[model samples]
Target chain A: MYRISYKAFKFEAKDALLYRIDPRAKLFVALYSMTISIITFDLTTLILLTIYLMIYISLLGKILRKIMRNLLVLTPLIIIIFLANYLVTFNIITSLVPAVKLITLVLSMNIFFLTTSPDDFSLTLEKLGVPLTITLAFSLSLRFIIVLSKQLNEITEAQLSRGYTLDRGGLIQRIKNFIPILVPMIVLSIKRSIDIAETLEVRGFRTDVKHTPYHDLKTTRRDVVFTLSSIVSITIFYYPLQDILSLFIPL
Target chain B: MIEFRNVWFKYDEEGDFILRNINLTIKRGEVISILGDNGSGKTTLIKHMNGLLKPTKGDVYVDGENTRDKPISELSRKVAIVFQYPEKMFFSPSVEEELKATLKNFGLEGEELNNRLEEILEEFRLVDLRDRTPFSLSGGEQRRLSIAIALSWDPDYVILDEPTTGLDGYSRRDLTKTIEKVLAKNKTVVIVTHDLEYLFEFAPRVILLSRGAIVFQGSFKELLENEDVIMRNGLESPKISMLMKVVRRDGGGCGMRYSELLSVIIERLGCSEDV
Candidate 1:
């Protein structure tokens, strides 16, 4: 019942300063960091930003551990990105730039998703003038990801219980073995989508009406402090700070 | 026999236990019903029997083999679990191909595979729909096909998780017949369900779980006898059982089914009508 509230990004109800910041400020930080990480190609600056993210995460209490766990799952993707960049550029230092940028982006966003509640994030979107339907669509897709992963796990178990061995065969045979799992997944996914749509209708969901949010969002001093620090950190990446830091810390 | 010896399980190390110290035994050929409210670990218990999940603290033994020692595929040769949603198990192009795939997975081939395929299709009344894709079949037909796939390999223990969910009266009757067939084969069938009426009809041995502990386990008649156990667990007794409770309060004897309950009520009223 509480899977959605607690399982998404392993959000914890903490008393930390990061948890107290306005979700709108947190969202700006996450998206802005992602934008900078994509545009800026300096490997030294990226690594320094990654270090800053790690330090920032440590200040949030035990969330650093959870963030590391999420990043571990993305290690393979990071390696693939690194390899692809290396094959094209043939420069070790240049290849490290994209990988370091991904780590920084993931770390920065993990702070947002881990600290902010789903309701708060949706409200942030609405506060920024997004339509209710679009916000619901976005939030529902994120929520259903947990459901889909769970369904996939159950389907895999069901197939295994039928004595189906996925790892025992040749490449062609192994790919063929996935059919039993894939078909059921597709069928269940379709059924789940229909059920969700029906539920929305039954619950009187409408796209035409305006909604009054229950909780009033208030931006406190912590949010202001967080936003200022985030802006300062973003600026530090562009100035003589990068030049000075690159001399001290070799890439 | 399936033995759960002090079995305790949690999904992760930091998570709370879902099944705690569940020391229970299910003998061969015995029809068992596992009852519990949602999140009380009914599905988790059945998953343990099939070796799909391993107990975190203790051991589960199926047919003298420790589940912790065997892979799920190896343990599944002895235990077949038909999940609540049958659609999650279908990936074949057609119903016949589905059965053939399961049989082939069990290492059957040639004439034996073809024979088992035809036999299962005929038994489940899927021979007519055998050419249809599983996704195209009706809900009841899909359920039947899923059960047929499970039974085709002839496992010693068959577990049905909420087999009656979304099934109509006719489809439930079909499920009853299927359960009867499984029992007649002398195979142990375990049903994890919330359908009390279905359980009353069969009156199988029941294990009631609450808060990760087995609160009650005995014959269904004994379970009905202890209305407090059922009520305390926030589960309603089957309607017939509730009606009989009123009858028994007014000096009627025990009965589980409708026919038996009718005779008991008539005897208590001291009236008989010729039909």
Candidate 2:
């Protein structure tokens, strides 16, 4: 009931080789291209990078419509950034280039978060020797989001039964509407986290213990090759791929 | 035999003790039952059998092996606890795989694993559901699948806590018959139940618990003869056990099996003259 969207996200990523790709690989290509896109103010380059990101995220099995839907939520905020850039620099091309960079960077992160389950992603971080505290922070915060959404619904229902009109509130007013949802949810989640931690301990969860995953994540050779190829595509596009195409078209 | 000598347990340190200075023994080949009111710590005590919960003070031993001293995987080989709402025990996808996983966890995989799995699935009438997802099955089918997984591991001491909690009459009988079959295999079954109506018919011993401690640990017949004790504990005599009381004659007793009680009823009515 909580983040019911995760079900649809799971269905999308079930076919995602890019998601199925090693986390290191996704980090290497997606993060690196995004960094380059930020440094350059070339409008043509930003457009190319955006196309690359769309194709890359599409490899996660999402269609154009799905990607646009997610982007639509950010469109208004993105337009605000474009307007701010236009006023600050008064260079329309300059503002447009960074705006595209901004959009691509956010899209890359969306791809990362959407395709990966918190469990697998955390385990991936752990395997890479991330600090226990850092991994735990990510795990608990992300886990909290899914659980908090569920608690929000439960709290709303309970309050509605008691004659609270959580449904009738403006954006600022909703902040006040959150006293019931916020207090009980935080209190309940902390208590529940403690109880669940105890339960996991009883079932033998230890930071120091070296145990195989009950459901192991084993990657095939195809996953390996495809990930390597995506990283090369990003690097080559930053230099050789774009240059090679320029010699032919002179654009 | 299972023994708890001076057992003291609390769900947490500095918390009120759930079971205080408890002393109990279940002899080998004996059918022992546990009874209690709500919040009586019946489940807390049962979990101590397999080291799922450790005692804060003293010890719980299952067949001379101290529970806290062994790893769960090892202790599980000796004592299997079927929890209340048995269907929830399965975390596996399909019934066959769920049964297979327990056998595998006990290091019982391979042809012998496949063979034993088939045999138990057949015994539990779960062969038809061997490929079916367990969570999608009916409530009764789900319960049967849970028992089949527990038995598939082939543990010695089986501890069941309120296994019939949410079951209907038909499912309850189905579970009881499965327990009887386990008994026929000479396994020591420790049943923690509040309802003795069915257990008194199929299982002989009915251990009574009052406030986290055993008040009585003996036959159901002894329970009926002591109505003051039953009433004081807020219990009613099971109907079949009460019906058998009329034919006690001189030395006979109530709490006979359903078939035996039926025969006694017919004989008292002079309806058994033909047989």
Candidate 3:
């Protein structure tokens, strides 16, 4: 059974410096890293981004452990990506490149999510002029990950106890075996969604009304310094320093 | 027989133990009811019986074999678990197909499979709904189908986790009948439940757990006699039981059943002749 704690990627109320910084700054850092990760095929750049996020995570105190634990959940996808790439190119280093890029992307995004509460993240999106509906959807999705994973765990255990072997079948048969697992998951998801919709309706949840943030988010001097420094360093590295590093790294 | 030898478990390495020093023996052909409030390690305890979870500190032995050394699929052949939500396991196109899928998992096929399928469909009263999708069945029918699927493989031990949860009066009665049928087959039935009223009626071997520890384990009558253990564990006795206690405290005597309490009330009111 997968005993994944629901609090792995959740934001905790901590007295760390990361929590003091504005969610907007964290969002920018995450977005900037993701944009760079997507735009560049350079392994050195991705490695550098990974190293930068690692430093940022360490500065947030003991959150790196939780972030690493959550990353294990992505291991299967990483291996699949590596195998698909190696099958086509037959180059080990080239296969490693995409996997490293994916890791870097996850590292950056997880840092932002771990430090920002859903309400704060929602408010930050609203501050950036996004629609209220989209912001609420994003926030609710983050909260729903725990619920969905828990439901998935329960369904898997229920099936396993009925003597259903997940590993007995060939590729097609293995996929077919998941029908017993997936059908219940979908049914439960629909039921839960209906329950949630009814709950929200009863609580007077509406898009037409302007909803205020539960906690007022104010950008302190720390956020300004952190945001400006991140932008300046990223611009300097992406434009000039990246070329210098690429020469030495020989990607 | 199943045995837990000083078993202790926690889902996370750094987390608090969910089941602490749990040592109990479930003999063959006996009914065991695990009683606790929510999160009192009731479900976690039963999961160890089927090798779904291994003890973190001690050992659990199923029929003299260590659960830690056995795969869940192998142990599942000896133990069947019916989870609280029946819909969480239903996936086949039809009710009959769902039972067939479970039976096939245990290596049954051909004539034997057909016989087992027919038997389960008939036993659960699902013959009329055999061709219907499991999702199309009513709540009680879906519950019976889930139990039927679990019992399709003819496992030696059956675990029902919150079997009566979200069930109506008639559905609860149907579940009681199902439990009686399982016991009649000489299967060891273990139930994790909070339905004390139903427990009072069924009166199985009650094991009370409090904060991951077994506070009491005996017959249902013994549990009612010691109300302190029940209250200390954040549980309330059945209404009939509470009423009996109240009457006894007032120097009046009553039994732990509704009919007994009713007769006592009539006797105390001096209205036996009026009835």
Candidate 4:
């Protein structure tokens, strides 16, 4: 099996517009966008929001490549949703709207995460009054998502090299082929977690004491303006504008 | 024999080439080592040997069959790779079951399968751990089990990637002895490693890569003599080689094992009577 590279989640250190914004502002934008996208059933509003997010992501330069790669991975799921809906409802054209909406929501989240590093994400959580232990747990989980996938990929390759064929099997047989891979992956993850815990203990990580960050997050004028505009736009779209549009446009 | 002709590779079309214009031939039963710094494409090159990766341009031939023509499963019968963290691949409840499953993939069954499994367990010194789960073994034992699983099918070519990583002094010696056993069976062995000491002692022919190209390809002695190439590639000479350089006042000969170094020192000190 080919290893899937989760390039989008990897941090980009370049100085782009999104990267330069305060992590809190970006996190707020992401949360707002996701909330607005979920509440609005209007296809036009979703399309407009998707276009806006697309334009913003396009401006991220090198990070745009990672976002595009992530979008490629989402293609199969989007296709499956569309096909399932069409099969059930027997309406191909209308069924696509939900799939497109899901894609837009994913793109909105990807835009935020692809630009923000894990360090900045934890800082955002800390700034939002999350417990230090929770913030540390969140950051460690994010880091290990990448690490565990790499371990899985290596394990898959190693098994394949040992003359283990994963392809060409019935459904049950195919899943059975993964037993060797899954068992080792779970075992390795447990081992890694123990190692991480020991390392934290050795480093004297304490939940009781207040911890200071290396890079202090300060909101600049650009961040303030972006955050305010995003909140206002999402507010207008989710409330009055959607209500007014729904009255004129049938359902 | 494995051959690469004008082979070039990149993971993405827009990405920088990882292996550029690699042309080389490894004859049957030849033991060779590939040395390179991180990101120098050592792993990428060996991945091509077993059809894990296909060249973007040109071709790779394993035993006169183009890698592109065969599936990885088919190519794997001719070449087996034991990855650095091979222990992570174990899934069988016991070591015997693990070997049995691998041999099953090669279409062995019944009495033949049991016999092959017994032989492999004996060869890797893993008979004592036959009933134990592979995950429960020590690090060194796990490594040996990994190699044993790879060799269960008896592929003509065995490639190891960074075998010495995370191995202790005794474990490293065990790995060396295992490789010696593989080589004794007249199997072609290819190793990709940063362990200069292992390479010096075991590999007679070394290919040094820098920036996706071979910079030096010769015996260890030639590599030692060309200090500029070694330094440029960010590699350190083996410890014994460095010590010999200091004592002899000039780099006369490079030694890997302790006994070789002792003999060199004795010869240098004019103690022929003892010899």
C-alpha DockQ of every model: 0.75, 0.01, 0.78, 0.72
The parts of candidate 2 lying over 4 Å away from their true place are A1-251, B272-275
RMSD of each: 4.2, 23.2, 4.5, 3.6
Q: Write the per-residue lDDT of candidate 3 for residues A1-251, one digit (tens) a residue.
A: 44545767456777787777888888887788788878878777777777777776777644788777767989999999999999999998888889989988888787577778888888898999899989988988888888888888888899889887777769999998788888988887888888988999999999898877668778888888988887777667666767888777777
Give residue A142's error in model 4 in angstroms.
Answer: 1.7
Interface RMSD of each: 1.1, 17.9, 0.9, 1.0
* Tens digits of lDDT, candidate 1, A32-107: 8887778889987887788877887778545877878778879999999999999999999999998988898898
Q: Write the per-residue lDDT of candidate 1 for residues B1-275, one digit (tens) a residue.
A: 99999999998778899999999999999999999888889999999997888899899999999998898889998999999988888888898888887888788999999988888888888989989989888778878888888999899999999999999998888888888888899999999987778886577899999989999999888888888898888788776876877887766544365556777767767788431
Q: TM-score for each prediction?
A: 0.84, 0.52, 0.82, 0.88
Mind giving the per-residue lDDT tens digits that candidate 3 earns over B1-275?
99999999998778899999998999999888999999999999999999988899999999999998999999999999999888889988898888887877778899999998888888888899999998888777778888888888888999999988888899888887888899899999998897778775456788999889999999877888787887888887666776777778766443244555666778777886456
Tens digit per residue, CA lDDT, model 2, B1-275:
88899988875444587887788888776677787777777888877777666788889898898977875556767777776654434445578887775676556768998889889988999878888976578767877776676777677877777777778989888887888888988888887777867666564676666776667766877777777777666566676655656678733577666777667666667785455
Fnat, 2 decimals, each candidate: 0.96, 0.00, 0.98, 0.82
Candidate 2: residue A92 Cα off by (Å):
47
Residue ranges of candidate 3 with Cα displaced over 4 Å: A1-8, A31-53, A69-107, A225-251, B243-275
Task: Tell how far residue A186 is off in model 2, in angstroms.
Answer: 21
lDDT of each: 0.84, 0.70, 0.84, 0.82
lDDT sort, best first: 1, 3, 4, 2
- Candidate 4 per-residue lDDT, tens place, B207-270, comes to 9998899888988777877878877897876666778677556444564445666676787788
Off by over 4 Å in 1: A1-20, A34-48, A60-62, A76-99, A117-137, A197-222, A233-251, B245-275
